[model samples]
Target: MAIIKLSAIERRRLSAFATCLVLSVFAWLFTALSSQQKYKVKLLAVFKNSPQKRAFHSLQPDSIYATVQGTGWKMLFSRMNGDDNKISIDLSALENKNYVVLSTQLKQINAKRDIERQVVSIDPDTLYFDLSNRLIKRVPVRLVTALNYQQQFAQSDAINIKPSYVTISGPADVLAKITYWQTDSLILNNLNESFNARVNLHPPAEGNLTVLPKSVTVKIPVDEFTEKTMQIPVKLIHNRNFYDVKIFPQKVKVTFTTSLKDYPDINEDDFEAVADLDQWLQGYRVLTVRLTHMPSYSKIVKIEPMNVDFIVKK
Candidate 1:
């Protein structure tokens, strides 16, 4: 086959024609998109200024379609920005009525928006609410945490949260089912010192729930732990025949770790070790030594002799 090549003059003429055609297409598109027109966009419905005397729950979802009159450029820019666009609806009319007409508030809502984004109409023009008895209650706040401690460090005392409870107001049925509110996760790593911070409570995602003082102060005590050894006397119990039992190595070394602050206060009396005579009845020669009592904050490392030999004097 023979290749047909165009001369330089022919190539220049073709390039000029192609450039003109492209420019013409762009000009037409620019004119069309610049014209103002009505378009539908999905907007989130945000309720505001709720009735003070009445509690209400919306009958429809928070999403609604809004017919807005604006240029294609403006609409395109709005979409590129984000989808968080929302329309605020005034609910003060619910004090006397159970429904609100979206058209009635269109003027007020549009007052805060730009001239190009005049909302012409809204689908589901009417909004209805279910009214209920208003209830106010105080509930406890629970702190959620994911914490990691350094070696030889631990929580020393009970966690303290200021204003441990928060007041909540909502429909009676909704509030009745809620017993406690939770804070956002208090996550940390390699925590060696006490933690004191203001944690925010998770906001209610649905219904007309309201939480007062949305944040609280949390304080957690931390300290360095050191090992301590104590000799605790063992006592025998559960002899059905009331036989006098003697246990060898009457005292066992109890190894545990406690905070430095409480090390001086902790004594052998704070711990109780006992051996069960029932072990002999169960055909076991050695009785298991168990620590039945110890401080709540102390960590038991180990017992010197887990089992002890016991003799029964019949």
Candidate 2:
């Protein structure tokens, strides 16, 4: 390949032409972007200033909408860049004024200095709130959780919720009516062991109330289970004068369900069967034997010979 070098005069002319092109582009851009245009942007509203003697029980229209106008470039950049384009407007100027912030009152907002755009209008044209005295009260906390255990397993104890009682603070009318606080619902499946976890408290349905200790601890005790059988001695009640009361098969077979963790601590002594001697003395030789006592967390499944035969001596 062959190459040729330009003369010094030609090079200077080419450089001058390049400079002119760059200058022309800048001039065109400045004129195009400087032209008057309209654009919209949102401004945040924070209303903390209220009359010294008044309090708020509720606030309506929690957000403020601002329709603004500005240059094309400014609007494009602001709307595209700050995804959170939020400009807070001071609203303390509106206190104890019949619970409202009118569209014309929007002028009291401090956004004029921050938002370079001119606000053309405000959405809703008005804000609303409920005013009343604040209050505090104590309420009980309730646990909300669903659990499923693996085969041959079950709960070893009752579900335990810490800080059973919580103190709630809010509007007097609201707190006075709330007697209990509920926890957020949770699900634990295929549980084969004890577990401890913290859960959030469910928020009140009304927007005017506040709850203390937003979360709570939950203790779920789980363990494997086993089936067991035992012979429970039956006793005859009433008819003190009569003695030597004979009940066929003096013991009743009691089958029960219990967790393996408490299996070792259980025995036949923990159960009992009883019959009414008065029934026998009343010309009823045959009577039904009842299983009256059982250990904690133990469920009776089947009792052999629900009815028993008996003979008595007067």
lDDT of 1 by residue, 122-197 (tens): 9989999998767899999999999999999999999999889999998988988999999999998999999998
TM-score per candidate, chains pooled? 0.91, 0.63
Assess each prediction's global lDDT (C-alpha) against the native. 0.91, 0.72
Q: What lDDT is reached at residue 294 by model 2?
A: 81
Give the top-scoring candidate (TM-score). Answer: 1
Clashing pairs in 1: none
lDDT of 1 at 32: 84
Which residue pairs in candidate 2 have backbone atoms (N, alpha carbon, C) closer than 3 angstroms, thus clashing?
none
Cα lDDT of candidate 2 equals 0.72
Worst 10 residues of 1 by lDDT: 75-84
Q: How far out, in Å, is residue 206 in model 2?
A: 2.5
Residues 144-226, candidate 2, lDDT per residue (tens digit)? Answer: 77878888878889878888888776567666667788899888899888989899999765544556788888888888888
Candidate 1 — which residues are off by over 4 angstroms? 1-4
